[model samples]
Target: MPPAVRERISAVTQKGVTLKDVAAAAQVSRATAARALNSYGYVGGETARRVLEAADRLGYRGNRIAEALRRGQLPLVGFVPGDIQNPFFARIAHDLEVELRKQRHNLLIASSEEDVEQEKELLDSLRSLSIRGFIVAPASATDNRHIAELAVGNVPLVLVDRAVKDVQCDSVVVDNEGGAREAVDYLVANGHRRIALLRDDSRIFTAQERLAGYQNSLREHGIALDESLVSISRSTVEHAVEATIRQFSRRDRPTALFTVDSLMTQGALLALRSMGLSIPHDVSLVGFDDFNLATFTDPQITVVAQPISEIGPLAAKLLLDRLAGNRPAIRNIRFPTRLVVRGSVLHPRKS
Candidate 1:
C-alpha cells in the first residue's frame, strides 16, 4: 500500500471508526451512509447493503446519544424494582429489557432495596439522564411523592407488580386479593380450621391485599379471626422463621400455614424442617409465587402463581404505546392468578 494511504487508514483507526470512514470505504457520500444506517431516507438496496457491510467491517457504531439529542429525546427507558434479588423481579427486568430492545430502546435497571429514599434517588438520577419512560414498582406504598410527581409531569410511566395509591397512570399488577382468597379457601376446604398467615408488613400494597383476602376467607368460612395466627411485619427469612416457630409452639397451633410470598414460604419450610415436621403429615402448607424450588420441595408446594411473563411485556407495551402518541385514558391492568394444586395440603390430623 502507498505510505499516504496507510497513514490515512491508521488515522481513521486511531480516531475510532466513524460514518465518514464507512462512507469512504463503501464509495458513497456521508449523507447516503447516514440514511442507510439510520433507516431514515430511501437508499438503493445495493448502496444500503454496501454501506452496512462497510460499517460492519470498519466496526462503525452510530452515536446514539448524539442522535437522541438531535431528536430532543432519549433512546433509553428505566425499570426501578424494590429488589432485583427476588426471582420475580429478575424475570420482570429481563422480559422488560427484551420488549424494550425490540423497539430500538435500551433499558436501565436499578434496585431500590425497598427503601423509599433509595428509590427517589434512583428516579432522580435516571431522570437526569433524560430517560424517556419508567416502569417502577414503588418501594413504599405510603411514600410515593416522587412517583406522583412523575405522573404530574406527564412522564410516560408504568407501575408494575406493586403500585402506589392515588397516582393515576398505566399500571400492571396481579390480583393479589383474589389469589390470596383462593389459597385460604382451598386450605379451609381441606378441613384445616387453624390456618396461619405469614407475610411482610402492610406498608406494601400486595401484602395489605393478601392480608385482607386471608381475613375475608376466614370470615366467609365462619371461622373467627385470630390475630395471633396472622404474622405481620416479617421481611427476612429469619423473621419469618421466628414467627413460624412462635406460632407452632403455641398450645392451639395452626394445622396449616399460608405464606404470602416466596421468601416467607421458604422460611416456613425451613422452620418446619428444623422442628422435624413432615409436610401434610404434620402441618400442611400453601404459598404464593410459584417458583422452580416449589416443585422440587418434598411435598411439592401448592401455590398461587402470578403471570410474571405477561406482566413485563404488557407493561412495556403500555409505555411504548404512550410514547408513540397513543394517549387514551390511563389504564390499570390487573392480571389473573392461578392456584396450582399440589400435594402440600391434606386433611387436618386428629389430635
Candidate 2:
C-alpha cells in the first residue's frame, strides 16, 4: 500500500473503526459492509467473510447508540436489586447475566440498597442509557411511581422476588406468606407459643407477606400476637445481630425465633451464641431463606427454602419475550417454597 493509504489506515485504527473504514479495508461499499456485519439483506459468501475478517482485524465494535436509534432497541438490560451485596441478589444477578448472555445482550446491574428514592434514581440513570428493559426488585412496593412510570412508557420490565401493587408487568416471586406460615406452624406444633420474628423493613413486599403469614399462623393457633416479640431490622447480619440481641435481652424472652432472610438468620446465630443461647436447646430457630451457612452450624438450621435458582432465569425469559414484541397477558409467577426441617427446632421449655 502507498504511504498515504497506510497513514489513513493507521489514523482509522487509532481513532476508531467505522463502517466506512471496515468497508474500505474489505474493498466493499459501506452498505454491503453494514449488511454483512449486521447479518441483514443478501450478502455474498466471500464478501461477507472478507468484511467480517476486516472488522475483526480492525477491532470494529458497532455504535450501539446509533444502532439502537435505527432499530428502536438496545442490546442492554438493567437489573436493580434490593441489595446487590446480599447473597440472594447476587445469585439472581448471576443467573440473569448468564441468561442474557445467551442472547448476545449485556446486563447492567445497580443496587437500590432497599431505598425507594435510590431505586427511582437507578431506573432514571439506566433509562438514559436507552436500556432495552429492566429486571427490578422494587425497594418499596407502595412507593414505586418510577417503576409504574417505566411500565406506562412501554419499557419491557420484569419484577423479581418483589412487586408493586399497580405495576402490571411480569413478576417472579416465591410464596412468602405460605412459607412463613408453615415455619410458624411447625414451631407452634412443637409446643412453642412465645415465638419471636426477626424481620426486615416492613416496606419490602416480601417482609410484609412474611409478616402476614406469621400473624395468620399465630391467630389460627389461638396464640395472642405479641408486638414486642417482633423486631424489625435492615437485611444484614450486623443489623440482625442487634435486633436479635434486643429481642432476647428482654425479661420475657421468646422461646422460638424466626428470621426473614439468610443474612438475618446468620445474625441471629451470632447473637444467640454471644448471649449463651444454644440452638434447639436455648432458642429454636427458623429462617425464611436458606443459605450455605444453614447446614454448617453444630445443629443445622431449618429454613423456608425458596426456589432461588429459578427466579432469575424466569425473569430474564419474561423480559426477553417482552422485548421481542410478544404481547401476552402480564404474568405473575409465584413459586412455592419448601420448609426444610432440620435440627433447628425442638420442644421449648416452659416459658
Candidate 3:
C-alpha cells in the first residue's frame, strides 16, 4: 500500500478521524461536511468533491445506522424471493444488485424459503432497516397482508414473478398460466391421456396460475380432472423426488410427467431413474423454467421457458423507476412464455 494511504488508515485505527478534521481539511464547515457525506441537503459541486476527498484521506467512517436514521432511508434495496437456491431467483438477484449499484444503492437479499410466515417476517425486518425500497417475489398469492400493508402504506415496492390479489403495485412477471397450458396442450396433442403434474404449494401465485392452466387445458379436451394425478411438493429437489415416487408408485402410473420448476424437474428425473424408468420410453417429461441441466440431460428436457434474462433486468428497471420518484401510474408488465421443444416426449403407447 502507498505511504499516505497507510498513514490515513492508521490514524483512523489509532485515534479515530472526526467530521471536524475532514471539514478543516476540505476548508468547509462541519454542516457542509455532514451534508456531503450523508447526502441529505445539497452541496456545491466543487465543495462536495473536496469534502469527500478529505473524508477519504482522513478515513472518516461515519455510523451508517445513524446516517440512515437521520436520512429516513438507506442506500439499500431489499429483495425477498421465494427461494435463493433456485437459479431463477439467483439470476434475478444478480441483475437487481447490478442495477441498484449503478444508482449508488446496494442490494440486501433475504430468501423467504417459500413460506408465508417467513416472507412476512423478512419484510418486517427489512422495513426496520429503513430500506429505500423493495423487490419481492412473494411466497403466497392469497395470504399476503404483509405485502399489501406495504403498498397501502406508500412504501416503494415492486413485485416480481408473482402478484397478490389486492396489493396494487408495480410488478414484472410472465404469463405463467399460458405457458403451463401450452405445455399440457402439447402433451395432450401427442395422444397422452394419463399425464401427471408435479407442482408447488397452492399458496404461491405462480403455482396457482400454472395449476389453473393445467386444469383448463384438460377440461377443454373433455378429459375429467383426476385429483389423484396431481401431486404437490415444495420447490426443492428432495421434496420433488419424494412426491414423484409417491405419484408413480400406483399400478396405473401416469404416461407423462409435467414438473413446475427446474428443481422439481431435476428431482423427478432422479426418482424416475431410481425406479429404473427410462425417458421418452417409460415416462415422457416436461418442465417449467429451463436451466443448464435441462439441455444437458439425455434426450434434453422439453420445457415451458420463461424469459429468464428479461425478468430480472426488467424488474430492476421498474423498482429503480419507483425509487426515482417517477410514479405516474403503477406499471404491471407480464411477459409471455414460450415452449422450448427438445427430445423429452414420445407417444402414449411408448410410455
Residue-level lDDT tens digits of model 2 in 237-339: 9999999999999998999999999999999999999999999998999999999989889899999999999999999999999988999999999999999
lDDT of 1 at 9: 53
lDDT scores of the candidates, listed in order: 0.89, 0.92, 0.89
Model 2 bad stretches (over 4 Å): 1-73
TM-score for predicted model 3 compared with the true structure: 0.84
Question: TM-score: which candidate is best?
Answer: 3
Per-candidate TM equals 0.80, 0.83, 0.84
Clashing pairs in 3: none
- Model 2 vs. true fold: TM: 0.83
CA error at residue 347 for candidate 1, angstroms = 1.1
lDDT of 1 by residue, 82-161 (tens): 78887889999999999999998899899988888999999998887778899999977898889999998978999999
Q: What is the clash count of model 1? A: 0
Residue 340, model 3: Cα distance from true site in angstroms: 0.4
The Cα RMSD in angstroms, rounded to one decimal, for candidate 2 relative to the true structure is: 5.3
